[model samples]
Target: MGLPAMAIVLLMALLQTGTAAAETRAFSKARDAITEPSHAQYEYIVVGGGTAGCAIAATLSEHYKVLLLERGGTPYGNPSIERLEGWADLLRDDPTESSERSPIQAFRSADGVHNRRARVLGGGSAINAGFYNRASDAEVRAAGWKPKSVQEAYEWVEERIASPASLGPWQKALKNGLVQAGVTPDNGLTYEHIQGTKLGHSIFDAQGRRHTAADLLFSANDELLTVLTFASAQRIIFNVSDENKQPRATGVEYTDSRNATHFAYLQDGFQNEVILSAGALGSPQLLLLSGIGSCEHLAEFNITCHVDLSAVGAEMVDNPINAIVLVSPNPLETSLISVAGITHEGVVIEGASGGNWTWQWPGMGQLNIFPPLERSVEMISLVQTNLQNLSSNTKEQIDQSGFILSKVYDPISSGTLRLKSRDVSQNPYVKFNYYTHPRDVETCIRGVKYLHKLLQTPAFQGFRYTTVTPIIALLYPELSSSEGERTDGAYIPDLKNRTETANWCRDTVTTIWHFHGGCVLGKVVDKRYRVFGVRSLRVVDGSTFTKSPGTNPQATVMMLGRYVGVRMLKDRKIAEETVNSRN
Candidate 1:
């Protein structure tokens, strides 16, 4: 029974272990409100205060004047975003207490899958599950970034936010099950990409404090950095008036918190640039709005197409997860999200959680799992079928909970991203055509079966119990119904008709939000993270990924910022030194 509470969030430490206090000061300053300077020129402008944005702007600010514009406010005062128990709260929208100005934006994919995106500073890292793992070597190679700097980037990000999590009872059971199932040689706690079971790191420290990417700014030269929260980048302002007109990016048009329009220009040289770290959704959407996407789409908004690149928003992919919930007979208190293992196929399996809102009848032998919505009256119909023998008096305790999540680390099938409208305010059309490829669907199924076999091993005999009903059946009871027409769109788990399983996976699928590859590397942007056909512009967020990495992408996204930022900082310094020598 993989009872899943679907939410993705993260926090980072400092650039070095000894600098934790300095990192705290950096995060605190980012949390503190700063006045927007009246002057509008900067050597570099980073759009989006997200995981990558904070890192990029902070890193570059050390050597040059930089401006970071985040559409949402700082994450400091909000408990819903900063606490561990509030992890799930980051995903759920609060209509009564929230407004359109709220930081977390709820969106629906083209396939009708619903999820959340963070509009706040620190972006998804501050609001995610806090699982902080570095990307697999495969991801680093494919991203086509400089290879040596990969470790440097990882070390840079790890120092700021990484901490090994102590395993709880549920996580201990998970490790035992995996080791028993031959899925592991038991790789202990690490931020490295290992083949077997390992105790992963988290952004939360021993005292439960959250240090996000925003904390990394502490390493930057604050005198050269100006962070403007609640400021949204609307479009890249191109210099069309230049002779030979190669579409040089000169500045950015933006809307402040008050919705007032403003334009911030770059310093005079070509070295000055506008970096879009607005994330997968925001980056591509901004490109399309700024007249850089497919000619046909931009034509709809009557915008002049400067660059007719068809792949600006192509190859958007997400980790479509399969969840199962199991109930434990005893209080299995150890910790939350402490243990994880990798299958031979690179699939990731993780243990239970306490932050979710699941209901149970306990000894009465009944458990209730909630999908984001009831979805259909039929989704939970079969959930109670396996619990008929227990008594009604056993109180549901958070300590006794057991559940797990299994996700495909290397997903092959990807979707496309397009504009809903030219407006920066509207969410884009994201179609994750998940499980569209045979290999992708096959991997997900193997992951489920692998974990299922692992959990049944003797290692879990005392701490966990075999679930009574198949989770897929419980999630989509319509599959079990003979009235096939009523459940026409549901997926069936039988191997004979894998297409049915694919359909079910698509219909019931939810993202762990490791969304990648929009404005992909080698497609929309070059290996250097600069946009093709557009000068002085680059993308430094998850949107630049060529493919999804096999673990939580938060660490990778932050590393990318550091990797790119370090290069840019070094290059600009050399360029400036050469100019001074010539003078």
Candidate 2:
């Protein structure tokens, strides 16, 4: 049916929006590139002015000279990025060809699914839906962060960026619907990720203005901070220690927007370091380019081996999303993720409304769905044929639709990220084996079943149709082994059957853009986030996560930057005092 194609269309559209106008507003401490008479040495050189990068750089600059390099421009006047109403435009306006100046970079995974990453200074927070929630207690315990410090870090970020969400009419219905469906114990409004239906905070303010990690820089000591825009990091410069023979990251080689080369280095202090906060994809890709991955893999691209850390780009994971589209009887207002249903079964329920897209399905007819850019033409043709045969009345209802989707929360199935080319701008080959693990598939089935229960509730009864199989199960009716008869002589899946539900999950699985785990903690980096084989180098981004922290990762990623920055300051102070005592 066209529903599967339409669902994919909706998901992709939800993840992306249009490009922002290029407006450069000069920050007192920021520049387009390394200016002449640049500081020869920095106590910290942070590559990637993204969510974590911005936070960590701001924190470190409190007492140290910090250099933050962002591959894209500022978000100050970018309407598509700074205003929440511009969300659809920012994601829907896909570029015909890749450009280095775009705020959002699009890529296709080896799984043949389209995904996106942020190139702007604020990173994903500059482009995402602005959902904000703290990591669960279990996630904190697993990471072994002290509770008191973790709380302080979260509060610090919250005070600057996070705020209570403004629930619209549609969001209010979704909240009640989730509660009625037995998600249990409505916690009202809260930022903590607990097991229940709760209204979480958002990074978008009451006026629908987005506050990103870049805003955190306001707290930074401007005299000690220097942010460079349009600066792409090419590789790390390392020097082998004379005494220990261990490679220490000494500097970084990067190119400016004009293709001019520049290098930034660390100070002479033992604690001076270069940190990589380039997200999951960017971080690992940089490692491979710098020859920190498997020696054999690096040799294929003619890169000299540095650390031979085979785990640099291994075990990549992404949370798979399965959604059900609902055609509202009346036009609904547009909204992003707000109300949440965090279930005990490892499923997180969220919804949005008023998303509309129209496509000219090749050779079929004009349809109200736009497939992801990378979806094969052959598949599109097949979907078009099926959609053409649909009754005119059915097509009309689909044009006005919203979506209630569930994420796999913590997926177990993983894959790898390998270099497609040595160029840092080009996307690496990444394959997230979604639904490959039995448990992941089973968890998705549970989520769908839960969604089915919600649609059956009184709050959602207005959208339900008894004569046909539920709209939720319409995506992949043919894939299911068990069938339910529709009045129109169409066969739909009986989702009540476990086997059918499992098949539905596998057929329609897609990403929620929460991919992580390329450079995992304890494997590639130590618990302190420092690379195992190298000194004066560390990774402090989502790439260091083995599992995502909460319902969303943006808040946690920002918190981590602050948390690690504070820890680094404390470590340096202790070392200084110890030296002073000996003297």
Candidate 3:
């Protein structure tokens, strides 16, 4: 071909590529219709486009005009998120990539645990591993949740999301290992069964697509639902005219990515409700910024206290988790599994009754273990026995596939969120206080030890496995070698004399990212999810969870959003009827 002709062809190809990219970009930008001033006002305002906000906006838009405000920009729609097999790739990104974009400013614990969350649209769901597990009936009851209410909601969510439960061959191998360790299959703790095992089914749709709230809700109304991306809510505007001091939220003031200020008004001056669906950290921070939290804290900022509710930022709870990575003799391809209730004799241990200690594993099949706490000890013994039983080839398979055992201990250490500065632009001061409770630390240690025993079994004899324990060495180097001796001495210190070394590891600790409980039900929000002493203001998100479920919270958050959306619609209808009757 002639040089001129070749140059022309290349130019045409470049234009085609740019056009295709623009079309894809336009598709994503189209969802941000709410940011437009003309589209600002709505019957309802749902803040934070994470798990619950997406569902709430989708449900409310079906019946009423809705405006959804998300602080982060549109997702990149990376191939990793789209492919079902590459789900782990989402978790493989650098911690900074996740942290810098997160709505909450995360910090490392004194002992080296990093608390991180997603700030982007679809919230954590966009970045999470998509492990969906329902709350156990006993746990719900303990939290003053009605069994019938939760069951109905769980069933609705399951059917809507088409909860993934089938264990493929890879998942089965992991399940086999867990069973050999004495974890029996329990369906009740699974997402579908509610009292099943801790093992959850992978969240995949009928077309084998990963099922996420973003996919479910965004697909519902591409044209109608206006999602405002990169718009951060600074504060909520309340109607000062209400004689009863019942706050009628007028609108919200927010800042877009371009640093432009914008205001979204409510419809008809109708005083529609404002739903704070921002996750635990974001919700409380927004409330405190709006002068609705503890009067003392707000007073310090010289902001007039709107509601002097002390519980607004108290009672923060998160399930502390520790992971164990083992090299299997067999090439165990990675497949997600939920081992709901691990039992030895008859009693289930993880979620036991008495405050947060209650035992409940929803969704997995119910197989009662003998003597609750003893089950943990027995599980350790059984895992050791099973490792001995596995063939050398099986160990090799697991090593190649990157077999990892994840253990989530019910955290007894309760933390609180306090406002460090009233500045909306600055992140709040959050104290996770993780591992503060000796029991929580012990449970985590036991879980790690349990995993180590499994790796030492004869089944894994020929496999080369390593235990990465930076935090243990940093905090208690003395316990390092002794613990290493028991596990074949795989401890190796990768960092040396760096101030941020512990912080980096803490930031990297594999977290479920299931932050919940600040502004929790009964403590901060009422049973109906309405903020105490405030009207026309409700919170709908994982933050409102009275207690964080033992497993993933995406399913629960979505269900709550739907539940609150339905309630809001019903309330509007009742008001309309009352006005008509009076007329």
- Summarize candidate 1's per-residue lDDT along 211-273 as a digit string, tens digits: 788778777787898887777788998987765757988888887766677788998986999
Residue-level lDDT of model 2, residues 1-583, one tens digit each, is: 2446554332233222233444434456567884623336799999999999999999999999999999988888787777766775555434233788888887778776557789898999998888999999999999999999999999999999898987776788889889999998899999899999999999988877888899899899999998999999999889965646778999888888888888899989899999999999999999889879999999999998988899989999999887666656665566788989999999999987664331122211112132233365455444434444554455544544566777999989999999999999888999988888999988987887787777767876554444444333443243233344221212223566778667666655666779998999999999899998888999999999988888999999999999999999999999989989999
Better of 1 and 2 by TM-score: 2
Best of the candidates, lDDT: 2
lDDT of 2 at 12: 32
- Off by more than 4 A, model 2: 1-27, 34-39, 241-243, 356-374, 377-399, 463-493
User: What TM-score would each prediction reach against the true structure?
Assistant: 0.84, 0.88, 0.73
- Residue 298 miss distance in model 2 (angstroms): 0.8
Worst 10 residues of 1 by lDDT: 7-16
Worst 10 residues of 3 by lDDT: 356-365
What digit string (tens of lDDT, one per residue) describes model 3 on residues 81-174? 4444444444333223434344333433222334446666767766555567766556666666556656666566666555555554444444
Alpha-carbon lDDT, every model: 0.69, 0.78, 0.54
**Residue 200 accuracy (lDDT) in model 3:** 66
- Regions more than 4 Å wrong, model 3: 1-30, 33-35, 84-111, 143-152, 163-170, 185-189, 192-199, 205-208, 218-224, 241-244, 269-271, 336-409, 422-425, 445-449, 456-510
Candidates sorted by lDDT, best first: 2, 1, 3
